[model samples]
Target: MSEAAEKFETAMPAWKQWQEAPWGRLRYAIAEANPLRHFGERADEPLRVLDLAGGDDGDALRLAVRGHHVTIADYAPAMLTAAAGCVAAAGLTDLVSCVEADANALPADIVRGEFDVVLCHNLLQYVE
Candidate 1:
């Protein structure tokens, strides 16, 4: 595998495990930084939001609950799987989409400007 792909593979287990924690769930439910504030007055619109490195905690789901269409993107398949369950449980399946994708090289399926709100929380620290 390429270096980036290998890194993602290695990171999957730890990411999955972390998502099982209470703190993880809490953090996702209440993101440290409020996205609504950053979106400014435009928050009223039907926003397309991207939560990069969203893991399985469902921060994207929370955003969706607030009337945004959110995409939960993560490099780990396990994370995506768990996120799917979370989305379903929250009845957010219609508003949230979980995608298996790296933060560094986001998939082409995620179009540029496709998202009005892009969250990179806790992701940049790992990338560099």
Candidate 2:
């Protein structure tokens, strides 16, 4: 892992806690509406989405609900665990995949252009 990846991993626990708070919920609600705003009506299609640094993956879940195939990637194991739980709870296991990966060094499959849309939000602020 890189220095930045290590810092993020160390902060994951605190970040996970905040993401369960009311303010975090509000942010998630707003993020969930973003794809529709950008993709318009076609957001509901079975498109492939790569959600990089997708902590807890709430936005990805929203996309999965719309029948999109989503891969939610984060460097934090705890975040990926939470995201996996959310995916299971939403009954979107088939539509969503949770991965522990750094955005700077993405997995080979992802580098192969497996995704139609890359959703990278609120992550660069933490990177050097």
Candidate 3:
């Protein structure tokens, strides 16, 4: 594993605990918000969405609830596990799927993947 990823795994427990807390959740709040604000006219039509580093934030699952098929690509396996659990709990197995991906060196799951909407809320400054 890469040094950064390995370090993140070591800090997984604390990260998860914080992320599960209400305050942390508020940082990525979208589940209960107006989906229309983000989608505008496309809100009604079902669109394929690619959520990079989406993890277990519940954002992808919420999009699936809106009838859009969502693929959540996260670098961390544990995060994907949590996201899978949430997806299954929401009975959105068909609408939501997970893939392991690292933006630094993306795999076909992300490189060749096709989608109508791509959500990457995290600040990603492209060096190139």
Candidate 4:
């Protein structure tokens, strides 16, 4: 296994702790990790965005809602499931897609040079 994978395995899994957190708490902690401000006044402009290690708090949901294509990628299945649920509840299933991916080594499927923006919200801390 890669050293990054090993570090992830040895560390207390962030996804697990996130699962136990109140929805509001996690949402506030990592609120919109930069997508909004980065867009400046181009809120109406749609772009393909990849949210690396995106938790289940809908941090990037705002982007997805505003007609931007968002892929919420994470290492945790549970978080992805919750994220799917949130997107579904918001009727954004068509706008947002959730997938399981490791930040250290992403799959070729996700690595295709197709995205216009990439947001790694709260992912660096877990990456080595």
* Predicted model with the maximum lDDT: 2
lDDT of 1 by residue, 2-121 (tens): 565457567877765666688766766567347776778877777988888887645776677777888888877766777889889988889988887877777788856467778887
lDDT of 3 by residue, 1-128 (tens): 55655655677688778868997688656543644477888888989888877766467877888799988877777778888888888899999889877765668657777888777755264213
What lDDT, from 0 to 1, does candidate 2 have?
Answer: 0.83
User: Candidate 3: lDDT over CA atoms?
Assistant: 0.74
Residue pairs with backbone overlap in model 2: none
Candidate 4 C-alpha lDDT tens digits along 46-67: 8888888876635657777778
User: How accurate locally, in lDDT, is each candidate?
Assistant: 0.75, 0.83, 0.74, 0.72
lDDT of 2 at 45: 73
Give the backbone clash total of model 4.
Answer: 0
TM-score of each: 0.74, 0.83, 0.78, 0.72
Better of 1 and 3 by lDDT: 1
Alpha-carbon runs more than 4 Å astray in model 2: 1-13
Global fold similarity of model 4 (TM-score): 0.72
User: What lDDT would candidate 4 get against the real structure?
Assistant: 0.72
Evaluation by lDDT, superior candidate among 3 and 4:
3
Candidate 2 differs from the real structure by a C-alpha RMSD in angstroms, to one decimal, of 2.2
